[model samples]
Target: MGEPSVDNMFSTASNKPHSRRKRMLSNVYSKSHIMANEALKAQISTIIYDRFLPYLASTFDDTPPTTTTEQPQTQPGGGGVFNICALLSATTMDIVTGYIFGLNASSNLIDNREELAWFLDLYNSRRSFNFWPQEFPRFTAFVERWMPGYRLSPKWVDEANGEIEKWTADMCERADAQVSSAGAVGGEEKAECVPVVYQQLWKALSKEAKGEEESGGTLSQQLRMSLASEVLDHLAAGFDTSGITLTYIVHELSQHPDIQSRLQKELLTLSPRLVPSSAPAAIPDPKAVDALPVLHAVIWETLRLHSAIPGPQPRFTPAQGCRLGPEEKSYYVPGGVRVSASAGLLHLNEEVYERASEWRPERWLDMDRLDVEKKKDMESRWFWAFGSGGRMCIGSHLAVYQMKYIVAALYSNYSTTIVDDTDIEQSDAYTAPPKSDKLMIKLIKAYT
Candidate 1:
C-alpha cells in the first residue's frame, strides 16, 4: 500500500484512470487468452517440467531431522522432507515473472534456493512494518521526517524496497530489449518464451505515446517507469496470493488423504500424465485439468477458507448514497461514506455454505444438489475471493490457470504428508500468509 506511484492499476483509486489502464492489457489476462496462449503453455511446461519437478526430486537427498534434540535419522527410502510452502512460493514467483517478463528473463527461484531464501527474507520481513506505512501514510511520513529517532518503518525497509524495485526494473529493461530487438531469439525453446503481458502493454503504450516528442512529452522515461510500476504490482500480487492458496491446498489435501487419492486418480486420467519421466514430462492440457471436478473443488474450497486477502477492501459510497442492509432493516447511508467487505467473513456465512467452518471441498462439488437459491448463493454470490464487479482482479484467470497446472503436476506423482504445521495458522494481515511462513511436508512417490 506504500506505493511510490499511482499509475499502476491497483493503486489508481479513481475508476476512470484504473479502467483506462486496465483496458490496455485486460485481454491478455482474460480466461480465453490464458487458456489458449501457446506461449504461456510452453512457459508453464518449461517451469513445471524443467524447474519445479526437478527441484522436488532433488529433495530426495535431504536427511530430515529425527528428533527435537540432536539425533537425526534417515527414513526407509530417503528424505523428501522440505518446506513445500517456500517451494510453492518460489514456483509461483517463477511462473508470474515468466509470464510478465519471459522464461529466459525470469527468476529461477525453484532451482536456486540461495536466491529464493534471500528474496523471501527480504519480501516477508517487510510484512510487520506494513501497517504503519500503509494504514497511516501521513503520520508515518511525519515521524520519519520530524522525529527521526522514532521512525515508523525501519531504514532497512527502504533498502529492501529499493532492491526489489531494482530487480523489477532490471527485468523491465530486459523486456524492453526484447521488444526493441529486430528479431526473436533463435531456438525451439526460446520460441515460445515471448513476454506476453509486457509486450501487450508496451505496444499499447508506445502507440499511445507516438509522435509526442514534438510536444516535449518525455514519453520514454515516463513510459518506462509506468510499465515497470504496473508489471511489478502484477508480479508481486500474482505470486504471493497464488502461493498462499496453493500451500493451503496441499495442507488440506494432506490432512484428507482420501480426497488427495481421489484427486490423484483424476490427475492420472490425463492423456500425458504429469509424472516424472526420462524425457521432459508431458504437462497435461490445462483445459483437461480444469475440467476435473474434484481438483476444481479442492482449489475453490481452499480459496474460500484461506482467502489470501481476507482483510477489508474499502470503497466509498456513491455520491447519491444507497440503501443498506436487508429490506426489513434497510436504511439510507450517507453519501461519500467509506464502506468495506471481508471475504473471510462473507465465506463463513452458514446460510450460504453449510458447515461453513469446515474444509469440505465436497461442498463446492455438490452445489447443484442444493436448492435453486442456495446454489446461486454458493456459486457466485458468496464467492468474493477475487472480489466482484468492474475492479475485480484482472489476473484471476491467469492465477487459476497456473494454480491448476501446478497442483495437477505435483499431486499426479507424489503424495504429501505434513511433517510439521507448528505455526501454519493464517496471519491477520491484509494479504494473509501462513503465520510461520513455513509448511514442511514429506512427499512420497505415489507409485515407487
Candidate 2:
C-alpha cells in the first residue's frame, strides 16, 4: 500500500480552463470562493474605513439597562434548565444563514422554543448520518441503496439531501429571478436583493450552459448539483463554527461579570447601533462590529479554547517522507498513515500560553511583548483555531465577523446571567458543542 495521491483530493479543481466555468459557477454561490477572493478585498475597503468603525462606536449608550436574574436549578430527573448545545446550534444556524442569505434564519432559541426543538431534531438526524456517506462513500452508497438494516437507510439520506437541495435551489431561483427582474427594470428603480451566494452562482451556471462545448456535458444539471453541495458545505461549516464560538463566549461571559461589564461598556460606545431598531440602517455595519478589541479577543479566546472542528486534520503522508515542524527533522510517517494535528491539543500548549488552560484575553494583548522567537513559535506551531494551509477555513473571517456581531448585539443591549451552571462541558465530536442542550440566561435590556 502507498500514500493516496494528494491531487484533486485537496486542490480546488476550479483552476483549469475546462473547469473555469464550473469555478465561476461555484464563485456565484461560494462567498469563500468568489466574494472573499475577489470582491471582499475591494468591498472591505469601502466598508472598513467608512462604515465599520462608526457602527462599533454606535453600539454604546450613556445608560445601560438592568436585567432581573432568575437562576434555574436542575430538577433531579427533569431536563436541565439550559441546554447549551441546542442554544449553540440555533445561534450557529442564524448567524451563518444570516450572513450568507441575508436572512435572519436563526430560531433564536431564547424566544422560540418549538422552532428550536424542530431545528435541533433535524440537525441531529443529519449529524448521525454524516460520516457514513462522506467518509465511506462507496460502502455507504451501496448499503443505502441496496442493503437492509442500514441504520440510516439510503432512502432517509436521499430524502434529507433532496430536502436540502430543494431548499437551496429555491433560494437560487429566487435570487436569479430578482437579478433578472432588476435588470429588466432599467433606470434607478432597481432594488438590491439579499446577499446570497446563489445569485452569483446561477449567473455563472447560466453562462456556462449557453456556451457549452461540443463534447462537454450539460452544465445545467452537473454544475448546479456541484454548486449545491458547495453551498451546503458553507452552510454546515459556517453555522457549526459560529454556534460553537457563541456558546463558549456566552458561557465564559456568564461566569465573568467583570469582563462582561467591560464588554458592555465598549459596546455602549456604539450608541444608536446598539439600540434595537427595526430599520436596516439601525443594524450596525458588519465591518465595524468586527474590529472591537474586547469582542475580538473574547471570540478568539473562545475559538482557541473550544475549537469546533478540533479533531485530526489528517493528510496522507508523502511517499518521500517530508520534513515537518520548525526543526526540519525528517520523520518517516508511513506513506498511507493519516498524518495530522489537533487544534484542541495545540491551543493548550504551555510554551505559547502562560496559563494555557485558563481563559485569558489579556494574553493576546501582550503577545507583542514576548520574545521574537517565542512569538514565532506561537504563530507557527501552536495557533490553529483554523486548520492550516490550503484546506484552512474559507469562512474564517465571515465566522469571526458574525460571532462578534452576535456577541456585541447581545451584551451591548442586554446583560446575560446564567440560569444554570452545572454540566457546561462540551461534547467530543467534529463540532465539539456544549453537552447540555439549553443555556438559560436572563437578558436585561440596556438603557440609553
Candidate 3:
C-alpha cells in the first residue's frame, strides 16, 4: 500500500526482500512455536474466558434457557440473540491484536460494542474504493494528476487509512514502551503478556540497521513505517479471515444440530474442558484441542466450502516465458503476463471432491476410507485454504490455533441455533465477508 521498502511481507514482490522479512518472524509463527507459546496460551485464555464468554453470557437472561429439540423462530428480552458475524469479527480482532500487541496493550473490542461498531465501519468503508487503486493503478494515478477537480475514490478513504495507520503506530509505540519497561523493572509476572510478533520484528529490523551502520552504510529512515505496515497487514488479515471462517462454522453447525451435538461431545472430552466454571483456572491444552478429529473436520469443511479469501490470488509470469496447461495440450504464454488461480474454483472440482457444493465434514473424517492417491490429492493438491509454497499465508498456524480453541471453548458451554440468516451468503470479493454482514443466532446453555 506504500513504498516497497515499507510494505508488508505479502506486498513485497521480490523474493529477497520477502524472504528477509519472513525469516525475521517465521520462528514465532511456526506451528510448533504457536502450539508451545506460553504467552499465546495466556492471551487465548484471557480473551476467551475473561472477554468472550462473559460477553456471550451478558446476551442471555440470568437463567440459561433449558435445552429443547424444538428450535424457536424468534426470542425477545436479551434472549441470547446476537449478530454472530459482528461478534465474531470483534472476537477475532481481540485475539489477533492480543497476540500482536500483548494482552495488556490490545483492543478489547469484545467487551465494547460501540468501539467494535466504529472500527468495523472505518475498516469496511475502504472495501468499495479498492477497485481503481488495486486493479488499475496507472489509470488511478493518471486521473489524480490530470483531473484535479475530480476524484476516483472519495477523500474519506485517505482519512480512513490515516486513522488506521495512526492506530497501528500507536500500538507499536506501546509495545516498544512495554519492552523497555519490562527490561527496566525486571518484569517477571507479566511473562505471559509479551508482544511476540512486534518484538521479534522490531529486534530483527534493529539488528539489520546495526549491521549496516558497522559497514559504514546509512541508517534506514523508514524503520517505523516498515514495522507498522507489516503488523497492520497481519492484524487486518488475521482477524478478518479467521472471523469470517468462524462465522460460517457457527452457521453451519447451527443448521445441523446433529453435527453441533457431535462437536460438543468432542470438545467436552478435553481434560479440564472449556466450561464456564473451569476457565480462568484452566484452559484445555491447545495440543489436546488440536488433536480432536471431529473439531478438525468441522473447521476444515467450513474453510473449504466458505473460504474467507475465495477469489483469485494474482501472480506474474516469470521473465522467461513459460508453458501452461496439461503437458498433452501445453501452450506457450509470453513473459510478464499476469496469471491467477482461484481456491473457490479449485475446491469445487467434482473429481477432487464429490458433491462439492455440499458442506459435509464427514468427507474429512472419511479420508482413510478412500484410496491412497485420491486421499493425497484432496489433502495436498486441491485443498488451498491458506494457499501453498513460500509466499503462502504466514499466519495460517496462528489462525487455526485461535479458531480451534475459540470454537472448543464456545461449544463446551453453549449450543447455538440460527435466529436469522437472511442474506447470510458470502459476499463476492477478494476477501469475502457475509453479504449482509450479519448472522443472527441464539445461544442456549448446554447442560448435560
Per lDDT, the best of the predicted structures is: 1
* TM-score for each predicted model, relative to the true structure: 0.91, 0.73, 0.92
Candidate 1 residue runs with Cα over 4 Å from true position: 1-6, 62-78, 138-150, 184-189, 211-219, 278-280
Worst 10 residues of 2 by lDDT: 1-10
Task: Write down the TM-score for model 3.
Answer: 0.92
Instruction: Encode model 1's per-residue lDDT on 155-180: one tens digit a residue.
Output: 89988988888888888878777755
Poorest lDDT segment (10 consecutive residues) of candidate 1 = 65-74
Per-residue lDDT for 1-448 in model 2, tens only?
0122112212343235425533444333343443333223223222322333232332233222122111122233332233344544555564454344433221233334465565455565666566665456678758756967655444565566566556555654554454454442232321222334554554555665675332223345555565555556677777777787787888888888888998888886663454545233354555456557788778878888878888766676666666666566655455555577889899998868778899887666666788898977676557898886646676676677556656776676566667765666776666776665446654445554
Q: Which candidate order results from sorting by TM-score in descending order?
A: 3, 1, 2
22-103 in candidate 3: lDDT tens per residue? Answer: 9999998999999999888888887888878887776665444343211121356647777777678888988888888887
What lDDT score goes with residue 152 in model 2? Answer: 47
Evaluate residue 311 in candidate 3 and report its C-alpha lDDT on the 0 to 100 scale.
69
Q: Output the TM-score of candidate 2.
A: 0.73
Structural RMSD, model 1:
4.0
Question: lDDT of all predictions, in order shown?
Answer: 0.83, 0.56, 0.82
